[model samples]
Target: MENRDVARLLRETARLLELRGENPFRVRAYEQAAEAIEQLDEPVAERVRQGTLTEVPGIGRGLAAQIQELVERGTSEMLERLRQELPPGLPELLTLKGLGPQRVRQLWQTLGIASLDDLEDALRDGRLNQLKGFGPRLHEQLLHALSLRRRYRALRLLAQVLPEAEALRERLRQQPGVIRVELAGAVRRLMEVVDRVELVVAGSAEAVQQVLPQLRQQSGLHGGMLLEGALPDGFPVRVALTTPDAFGTVLWWHTGSEAHCRTFVRTYGAPEPCPEEATIYEQAGLPFIPAELREDRGELEAAAHHALPALIELEDLRGVLHNHSTYSDGRNSLREMAEAACNRGFRYFGTGDHSQSLTIARGLSIAEVRRQQEEIQTLNEQFAARGFRILSGTECDILPDGSLDYPDDVLASFDYVVASVHTRLNMDEKTATERILRALRNPHVTILGHPTGRLLLRREGYPLDWPRIIDACATYRVALELNANPYRLDIDWRRVRDATAAGVPIVINPDAHAIDELDHVRWGVAAARKGWLTPEACLNARDLDELLAWLHQRRQSVQP
Candidate 1:
């Protein structure tokens, strides 16, 4: 597991332990581990392998041992024992923001609140507000947090977030001493939103002085704090700074976490946190970890011990597994969409338009599906003539009861099916998860399309235990579709490592209702790469024959 994955698990473990009323120190140990692992200069996997993981100050030998065990085995025996020891759904309680470990302990120990549902029940029955110290205001905030939990969470792209970062990058580009300039941070990481725009420039202050003042002049920041001791464009984004001593350091800091940098203080012995992040990491002795993994989730620990995984990249994608067309809610015809995919250099394109249930949006009927098949056949003919290929496909909906729109016979006609949840999305956890899980078992369903029916700013589709759903996908050989639409990048990029670690392959689908939507694949691609997706972990990265073979194997297994 990578640091982000480990950190997230640690946080969840803390929540579970808190809910079960486990020891406070043990809980704190997990939380502290999360914090320490996030800022390490190298991947922690390397550290455990080298037998020197405990050299990092925050984590003692026990925590380091836990990290080692987790990496070797897919999970920690300690975490599993906790699972057997706690309320079953207790860990999910952590995902509810505004509810800290202390409050969770209170509700679980005193009021028997183990999960979001139980907590909600207590709130609705007027039991939660009655608790000491958690009066009306805290109760109210808890409800708000619960509502947000049922909704989608996103971070905007850095460039889209920080406009000034762009201005500074241009100025740095013009400087002769500057060797390179690029926007880093959430912008480079491809987060949907961001707190700052990171601009990394390579140069001596003498070479960049002329360009530095131009960056500070622009507005909207904590007043050049990011740039204070460093490069000029650096300061005003989030922290301060306008100067960078070297391009490499800028690259490291710009790509790391705001919370993680604080770990460098002289806990036992070390230089004070340096003005530049490079000195801080270098003194500890290591290579830089990417900012995307800095969630206080053990990234630093992983880096300290060398535990980073090979990240996924755009080139890893050899095909387009999911995209829409004029057949359903899409904008272009099947041929047009296929041609678009071919232009982007994909080996195959799956035309996954909506299934029949979405009648209002003109989702395909059986007759219409047959017509689509004919058109796909024609397109395949032309593609062969031109040395390109298109695979017939459908984004079949997993109905409210867990059944796909079409029967196996109808589904059999297609090369692949991108099964998804579309309507009746507000079901409770059990119902939502089981419904999708049942659909995944359908013989024709090659992939589970956007497990969470989210539409970013529009609505949070439904609530389901994603950890459980991810496990189900792996058991069934069903890949989880990463709908790459800018607005609906569902099966979120943040969940990439978890999904991959579970032995599930991700298909980055630009769930394009239109041909232009195909381009938004870059956003999902960035999220995937940042999430540490490897080429093998992404099904779409495989060539057409490989994808077809996978489908054939899955399909035959479903048949008599």
Candidate 2:
């Protein structure tokens, strides 16, 4: 399989290990492995099959052997055994605040806790606070966790609206005097996810002008468009078309990162004499600013000084990273995932699944890890028969106490690693950052998956000092994962810009568990560009060889 898939498998394996009360260090190892794989350009499983697995580094004999077996089998027996040992829903418990592998295991062992509902009852009744390590403070946090979970469940995948946007585009095209119409804002850049859409119209005010009014006239349209007017600071949205003369200037100015845009205008004062955008920019003496950077950040200023580097584009990406399959709570198989990536014109695909400790997620164990690896290899062989590339990977869970899911030796088995937290979300800023920092030091950790564990509308992640996290990532040269999942756009857009400024490469990952989910990367990339990220700040934009070499550095034990 390819590096992307290898990274996914490592991550899932780690999460499963966490749910099972596996050694914290072990979980960290698996997570580190995932980080390494996510940054790898080549498929680790293929290397194993070619007797070159250890040649890439960190991979010791034990992990390499496990990977070899996974390349031959289709499942891992150890993971299955863990599932049987723990209550079927134990992994889901880990998602709550004040919860982790150890605590959850303790609750299950001592209080017979099996789900979030049971834990909530215990906390309300004061039973949970009586536990030796946990106190009232933690109990309160659990309540917040439940509340956050409810709020963060609904970040819709932006790609899901492409068809609707297209339909609207068609409707706009039929208008008179409409010379051109295209999506602007985040959607135009093919980002990993998005919220709303913006359309740029090229025509006189009269041409597309009718479109907005027509929308208002449509049955039920005016009511839907009405503002709630219920909040103290609620904003209203109005649709109208302006002349092309003012189109670019107005649209770009309004689209925002006011900081970025203010920098642009301040550095190059408003264009005088020319009412048209192109002429204004030409007079301003800067190459036309890309709409993506209209955020009014210092990008406009930097561009004037010829200091800003070329930005990355969607076409620069060679493969798909951070995906999952049926191996652990995913919805597709290795082969299916590979085909989808290939169809998207990607050079490789990463298939990550859950680790063994995540019982609720059906994580993998030692034996199952081998089987899954084998299955990945079998899929790769099948793909190869038709000239395709796939990678075996995993998304490993980061354990509490600053550790990963699997042993170092076992973790080094796959291609890369994507380290993330699946529990203990209530830890205060200090401990949470420390926990993640320790995992970053692992030679196998190549990337930190979703620095923030947030889920949009459902829950916020543990408090973190983002400025420190960005600095740490830069020091370690660990790629910061921009989880493109709509529900969990962690390493938020604003921070993404800061990360680029700090010299940490960003990987926009969909964290897709199904084949159709790969498209989520567009939203994240849109968010990234809005922050003025340059091409060099993104690992996924590099060529395969360059990507592999960079990833090897992360492993710290590899030379090839």
Which candidate ranks first by TM-score, i.e. highest?
Answer: 2
Candidate 1 local lDDT, 310-389, one digit each (tens) = 77777777877678776775646677778888888887887887888887557899999999889888878878966678
lDDT of 2 by residue, 346-459 (tens): 777776676667776777787887887888787777777555566656678888887888888667887778888887776889999899988887767777888878876556
Compute the lDDT for candidate 2.
Answer: 0.67
> lDDT, candidate 1, residue 547?
79
Error of 2 at 205 (Å): 8.0
Candidate 2 segments exceeding 4 Å error: 1-166, 177-237, 257-276, 385-387, 556-560
TM-score of every candidate relative to the true structure: 0.64, 0.65
Score residue 168 of candidate 1 by CA lDDT: 68
TM match of model 2 to true structure: 0.65
**What's the CA error at residue 132 for candidate 2, in Å?**
22
